[model samples]
Target: MRALVLDRPGSFRVAEVPDPVPEADQIVVQVECCGICGTDLHILAGEFPPTPYPITPGHEFAGIVAARGADVRPDLPVGARVAVDPSLYCGYCRRCRAGRDNLCENWAAIGDTVNGAFAEFVAVPAVNAYRLPDQFDGQLGAMVEPLACAVHGIRRLGLLGPVSAEPTVVIGAGTMGLLMLQLLLHAGAGPVAVVDRVRYRLEVARKLGAAQAVTDASALGDVRFAVAVDATGVPEAVETAIGLLDRGGRMLVFGVTPAEAAIRVSPFRVYNDEITITGSMAILRSFGEAVDLLSGGAVDPRPLLSEPLPLEGYGDAVDRIRAGQGIKWHIRPI
Candidate 1:
């Protein structure tokens, strides 16, 4: 099988590697599409500590089942199309036991900690692969992972239970931000405003149903929101999102910021106004809901996708992502 192998930070190649064979209770998937994420760039730069070198780097993906281990259930037979949840947790850890598996003490993921779907074939645990509906194509199936993350973020915002029309401000109109915007609208969150420096992304946000889309938060001056979400992974942007919150506002840090990154929030304001600030990690039990949302036509991420690249185009795709050329990029290894 041909895969984009990252031998170390700052270096990678499309190399020929032996095909993956499913271990016990695992299934081998013929990868159809794999989306590059910010975490992928971090892994490439040696910034994400959990990543190991000489590994295949891709997690957001979907594919057809090519083989299954002997113990796998009949429901997950070969040829089934599916989207995989890359999260790998030590089930016995305290965090996992507490139902916070995303924060597992021995946390790992498919692409982050093991060889992943940036190849013609990859082996994953059968339990992590959620079967997709017949209507789901490769690109849309690949989107389920990010949408799952957004779903978890929404759950963290406490908006899942009821139609809490909290005036919401989503910072950064990138793929994740746009997904957040759509979910906010779907959850009946009201008058959702989107902020991004890129006017192009703001346009996309508007088309996707943002009540207000601006290149900068200053454009919405004096308009405080009840919910503030930072999806840019930029500390400055996080602070800007914080500034847009109303009294008693809830702020969700949905972005992946650096470990050393820090933000300034008024402690006095948090105390006086009873502000709630929460951080969302990766996918939790949200993957199934995301799959349902996508398969059922409730969320459309197709607008965020451009033409996918072949396995060999992985480097160029990375450059495009770094250059901010597109909303999302995918790799079709098949």
Candidate 2:
């Protein structure tokens, strides 16, 4: 099998590697499509501490079961179409026991800590595979992972309705930002606004139900939001989003910002206004719900997807994402 193997932080190659064989509880999946995520960028830059060297970094993916281990479930047979949950949680971890597995102490993931789907084939635990409907093709199935993250973010955000609809601003119009916007709208968050420097992305956000899509947060004028979401993972953007919240507003940091980055906040404002600020990590127990939403047509990501690049185009995909040239870039390894 061929894969994009990163020998170190600043380098990678499309080279031949041994095909992954299933473990006793795992299955070998023929990867169809794997979306490049911000985490991937972090791993590529050595900024993500959990990642190890000489690894394949891609977790947002879906594929067909090509082979299965002997103990695999009957329902998850070979040749089945599936979208995998890359989360590797320790069942006995304290956090897992408390139903907060996303914060598990021994947390690891397929692409983050192990070899992942930036290849022709990857082995994943059978239990992590969710059968996709026949209607979900490669790209749509690949969308389940990111949507799952967004779903988990919303869950972390808690109850959103406040008697009536109010403005919910989503900062950044990238893939995650746009997905967050859709979820906020479906949660009955009224007249959601979107902010991004990319005009095309704002246009897409408008098409996806953003009441107002602006190129900059300042362009939004003095308008304030009952809820504000930062999805760019840029510290400056996060600060700007925090500033957009109205009195008693809730802020959800949905983006993966720098671990060491700090932002200025008015302690008096938080105390006086009763403001609540929270941060959402990756997928928790939300993978199934994301698949359900996509299958039911409740969340549409087709507009955010662009033509996928081949395995060899991995570097180009990274550059495109860093340059903000596209929304979601997928690597079709096969």
Candidate 3:
């Protein structure tokens, strides 16, 4: 099997490696499509501390089941198409016990902490594999992972209650931001306002149902939203989103900001306005829901899909993502 081996930060090569053999409770998946994300870039630059060297980094992916361990569920037979949830949680951790597994004390993810699906074949826990509907291809299946993250973010925003029809503001019209915008609309959110520095992305946002798409929040002067979501992971964008919230509003920090980044927030305003601030880490129990949403066409992944490249072109894919050339770039590893 051939895999992208990151021998260390700033170095990687497409080399032949032994095919992964499933553990007692794991299954081997023949990789089909794997989406490149910001986290991959972090791992490449040695910015993500959890990542270990000499590993394959691709968490958002889907493929066909090639083999199964003896202890794996009998229901998941070989040849089944599945989308994997890469979260690797310690079931006994305090946070895991409390149903907040995303924040497990021993937090780890398949791609981040261990070898992942950026290869011809990868082994994953059988439990993390969810069967995709017959209608979903590898591209759509690969989208489930990121969509799951966005789903969890919306849940953190308290979407269970009645969502006010007031305009919701989504900062950053990138793939995640656009996905969040669509989910909000599907959940009955009133006219959404999307902000992005890229004019083309704003246009795509409008096509995705954003009532208004602007380069900056100031373009919609004095406009306040019941919910504001920051998907840019930039401190300045987060602050701007918070400032756009209305009284008694909620803010969801769904982006991965720098560990050293800090934003200025008025404590007095937070107290007086009854502002609620929360953050969503990664996928929780939302992977299945994301699959359903995608299958049902509630959220379209086509608009976000960019041209796929072969596994050997991984470096080019990274460059494309870093340059912000497209909504989502995928690697066809098969």
What TM-score does each of the candidates earn? 0.99, 0.97, 0.98
Q: Give the TM-score comparing model 2 with the true structure, all chains together.
A: 0.97
- Please identify which of the two predictions, 2 or 3, would achieve the higher TM-score against the true structure: 3
TM-score of model number 1: 0.99
Give the alpha-carbon lDDT of every model. 0.93, 0.91, 0.92
Model 2 per-residue lDDT tens digits across residues 47-94? 889898999989999999999999998999889999999999998978
Model 2, stretches more than 4 Å misplaced?
160-163
Q: Write the per-residue lDDT of candidate 1 for residues 1-334, one digit (tens) a residue.
A: 9999999999999999999999989999999999999999999999899888899989999999999999999999899999999999999999999999999999999999999999999999999999999999899999999999999999998886557676899999889999998888998997999989888898899899999999878999788899999999999998888878889999999999888999899999899988999999999999999998887777899889989999999999999998989999999998
Q: Give residue 322's error in model 3 in angstroms.
A: 1.6
Model 3: weakest 10-residue lDDT segment is: 158-167
Which sections of candidate 1 miss by over 4 Å? Answer: none
Candidate 1 weakest ten by summed lDDT:
158-167
- Clash pairs, model 3 backbone: none
